[model samples]
Target: MVQKIVHDWATGKIYPHFQFVFSFKFRDLNTLNCSINLSNLIVVFYPYLRNALDYIWKNPERLLFIFDGLDEFKSKIDFADNCTEQQHKCPDPDVRCKVSDIVYSLIQHKLLPGCSVLNLQPSQFLSGFLMELLEREDSVRSVVYTFPHLTIQEFVAALAQFLTVAPRNIVKLLSEAHSATDGRFEVFLRFVAGLSSPRSARVLEEFLGPFPNETTCRVIDWVKEEIKRQAGNTWSEFGKRSLLNTLHYLFESQNPALAQQTLGSVETLSFRGLGLTPIDCAVLSHVIRWRFGLLHGTVISRIGECQIPRARRSNPASGLVEPLRLLMLPTSFSRDYEFPM
Candidate 1:
């Protein structure tokens, strides 16, 4: 259907006109209390179609109705119910009925049966931009080269957030990113934090004009507060993950003073059940070096016993000191966890 429409548009056979109907407009239609017939709907919401009502009715097959942001639609659409049965359907274009009934009849194909109806959610609407990106030759080549790695994707997402989001709301954005426990935003959060640094911001400014200083400051400040909060609760899994995340953010910023202010009072660090990745250990090693030059009295229990050696092998200069106390638990008891050095 979409291909045919595009072909028609290209060949100048049909000039498509867009009629926008937001979710709020549907609510308004329901509350108007006046006759909610097709002619009135055309006159009120789709004014351009008012004069072409007869033409539209005669050639309903040529019409395409796009219902976007279906996720935000408040009213229930019961597909199984016979509420819009043959007798209740609005057969005539000018027939009056409840707004919901009209919608039901349209969707159930009792009205304008030959017309195309497209339903889309917010995410699906945004995916059109990604489709454009995928259509580009350079972007396609980049995708092929980076097959499984999501680093570029994460970086682009971070960049998009910075470019679009306001400085005042940056704190809230970071907070929401930090609160995600599934680790889906882990690398993305790190990119966001890395972009907060003056050096990184300056690099970005060369291509995208002046980056906002207020947003960077807000992100930095939010990281500090999170570190402070996570430092006090390092025993729990959530605290361990959050503290590790903040440390990565801190390391990304390359701010020694921020690191010292946040981690100065901490004596002992615990990373028991958390499975430390090489990247996690590298960040941990950097943060530890930044804190004490050489961290002593470190305790790594269970899974860290295996991960630390691998992290050390990957980066010998990571300076992952031998654990003073290594308690190895059985594999059955192991759980994924994270911690700061």
Candidate 2:
């Protein structure tokens, strides 16, 4: 079982980290979590630590192995892809062997003459395996079998540590109704965790660029003044009132369509030969109505017709994609096709 687990991790098919809980006779039941380090044959090995109580309760015969913690060594053990610090170093150049080498070494002889080495890469922190395993019903139950489980406050603290941000900043954000609400923040973390699409990570990358400084703020002010000037000239008295109403709706109501429309009117622009899926529509709408433009609706409508496939619905909500950021459609289509209204 141990060899199989190690082999899977080495091949990038499974996560390397494992938490073992043992139930036994005489000795105290315990749980241990960490990576393996077989090189050091020091005094037969020692048990490191435990995560949850139930880990020990489930496996009784293997309880001796629980206390024999050779597998849970904490030294800097480097795998093939990335070098770990302290004891386990990266494989030597001469040790450039296939992944099967480690598997064979561990499982084949049951005893070895010298050090048998293999390259192991650090797993992606938020891999699919972790998400499924951690979120599973059994897993959560196993975790809480020991205690009452962490409170929301504890969860928030853990998140802050993982994010490397001050708890105060996160607390303030979560305490309000603005972009930092609990759901929004969880969504944000899930995105950063890079579990599903890497696209969300890229969106986060864009938002995380150097924040606005004095020069940027000045530019914002200049842009606002220019927009105000344009608004005064292009809008009639009723149009101005309606525009203000649109702005209010965007800020107040959660209606994405209204927000999109308001943003679209702020600019006149069109991307050509683009095939917009429903996802693209939501993103495009968000960018234009509130953030960017003034009634380029005719242009948008024309492009929408030309680019989107006939069978697809025009409604953006049909797509599973969220409008966290704008997504541009592919730009490789024929240029001769004009936008249709």
Candidate 3:
């Protein structure tokens, strides 16, 4: 539902207002092919490009090209060069190529003129690619604006519909929870933070409901009540307020995928170039390394107990290594904190 809302919003605000059209995707771009170049891409994306360009040429706002997961596509390409090919005859161009081929062509200037391009991808990866792309003397960089994870206000507004709670109440609850948790607030807040998108909400619900045993519920309820009492506030204080603000920062930073879903068809999404303070990076690195070590130890011990003969390991095609790798991968809570951002 939120995806629909955002698509509508973006189309209303951005489409038919720009002059040029350019798009890029990571996979076979077969779904976005058009009659003009149907042989090189997907056909489903044709209307989008047509409408977008029409809006740009007919209106003054220019156009905003919302490209998503370019980094993911790049990763896919790196891992499997010809990953998403499905043969289909083009009605017009009569040529045959993967969807990714078409997207690459557009980005390479096989499309119309007077257009801007927005490449969305993971922050760190996007930063590196954009830096490289912008290095050329004719490349334009300043027009691009990379939006960070959603702001506190945007988060609040996004969650407001599903929560049915006033903004102030949410804020008050978070404040009270923070004071009562004795600094375990980050863990608690994770349970309630998320946008209304199905994927984002699913992640949030899992956090909240993952451990649904009686003991977990009791802990949650007790914490809520205790926080309310300690904060000297009414039971109303136990509402969603505590989750609203810190969640904006915590959930968005913790789950960029969720952030993208919540924010909708944005031009750029990236984790690189994040202005993390030196102290913050230092602390994060320490925590990550410690967790990695603990998980590594657990894995090595598990593998040691396995009864596989040493000579079997010498078999070139033996699968022992893969399972051992999985067994050793970190399962600790602190370990996962490093990846979500």
Candidate 4:
């Protein structure tokens, strides 16, 4: 079981982080909130987390694992049952064990040999697991550090609003109004969803990026509607800039259709074989710029250089080839195509 878990994490198939493993709620009959607290620790890990496995792997001996605030370690441990020094650091032999039992095994020089660990606390913390492990090993020890003060009052005051007030759910409202063309509202929803700001979008990527396809499509649709509703001339532009940012988000979604869907009237500005004509070259260039005028440079570059197959919806349906960043599609039927760098 341990080996299997390690293999999966090494291959990037599972969430591989030390905190993730530590946060696991082992089977315990003592507490009502044991399981709930473990899952809630996940909420704590959600905001910011560091994957320390790689660094630990590289220098097991030199690395010192500092686990601050031991009081936060909610689950109980069986301090006596140290796995008696076994091999394998990542998952050990089994995970069907308590947090303390696992930490005990690691402390016994069973997992990640030569690695040292130190525990810090606000006061004389008494976890049998830590005390037993430290006594069991001469090198291991614990220390209590004192701090001046942490202003939790101000933090709580700031956090109270978000905890009390509900979010403005525009998606449901827009869904009702734009039922028929709801799919076309991704731009507007993206703007609103990100709080219509670049900084907000970056933060939201973690929370919202991994949403399922159905939810993603719906949010994209609602955003599209909002963008269209706000569209106007770019002289004192408010909408155009937001529209551009949202369009960038759409392409980043890796959903090919959303990229194509944004061009309402000019889904296919077909330039097949027509680029040879002077008038066609001028007109096609203009059309490309006008339709995809708001997208980022990479999107524009890929779209411009990529060889569109004779069909958008094609046979054998190899699906859309990944946009080759520097590959140019041949204007003619010849496969050997080249464009200036």
- Which predicted model would earn the best lDDT? 1
**Sorted on lDDT, highest at the top, how do the candidates line up?**
1, 4, 3, 2
Query: Model 4, residue 54: displacement in angstroms?
Result: 31
Write model 1 residue lDDT over 1-341, tens digit each, in one string.
23443455456654333222212234344456655776677678667867878866776655555454455566666666554353355766688876656666666667766554555443231222222232212231121212134676787677666665355677787788789888788888888889888788786665454666677778788888988888778777778778878889999988777888888887656666676666776676667656653444443323533333112112358756443221233343246433333
Candidate 1 similarity to native, TM-score: 0.46
Residue lDDT tens for model 4, 95-151: 334445445545555555665554443332222122222222224442222222233
What tens digits encode model 3's per-residue C-alpha lDDT throughout 1-341?
22332354356642333443334444433243433353223234555454343334443235334455564563222223343443222222335444444344333333323234455543222322222223212234323433343343243333332334223245456456566634445443444433422455565444222222332333234333433333222223232233222323333334333333332232211122223333333333332223222223232232222211111112258644322121221332222111221
- Candidate 4: which stretches are off by over 4 Å? 1-24, 27-214, 230-233, 266-341
Off by over 4 Å in 2: 1-266, 292-341
The 10-residue segment of model 1 with minimum total lDDT is 136-145
lDDT of 1 at 88: 55
Runs off by more than 4 Å, candidate 1: 1-150, 293-341
Top-scoring candidate (TM-score): 1
Predicted candidate 2 versus true structure: per-residue lDDT over 159-209, tens digit per residue: 232233222343233224222323334333322222112332244324222
Model 1, residue pairs in steric clash: 274-337, 275-337
Error of 3 at 170 (Å): 19
Question: TM-score for all predictions?
Answer: 0.46, 0.23, 0.26, 0.26
Give candidate 4's whole-model lDDT. 0.37
Steric collisions counted per model: 2, 27, 28, 13
Scanning candidate 2 in windows of ten residues, the lowest lDDT window is 23-32
Cα error of candidate 4 at position 197, Å: 20
Give me the overall lDDT of model 1.
0.60
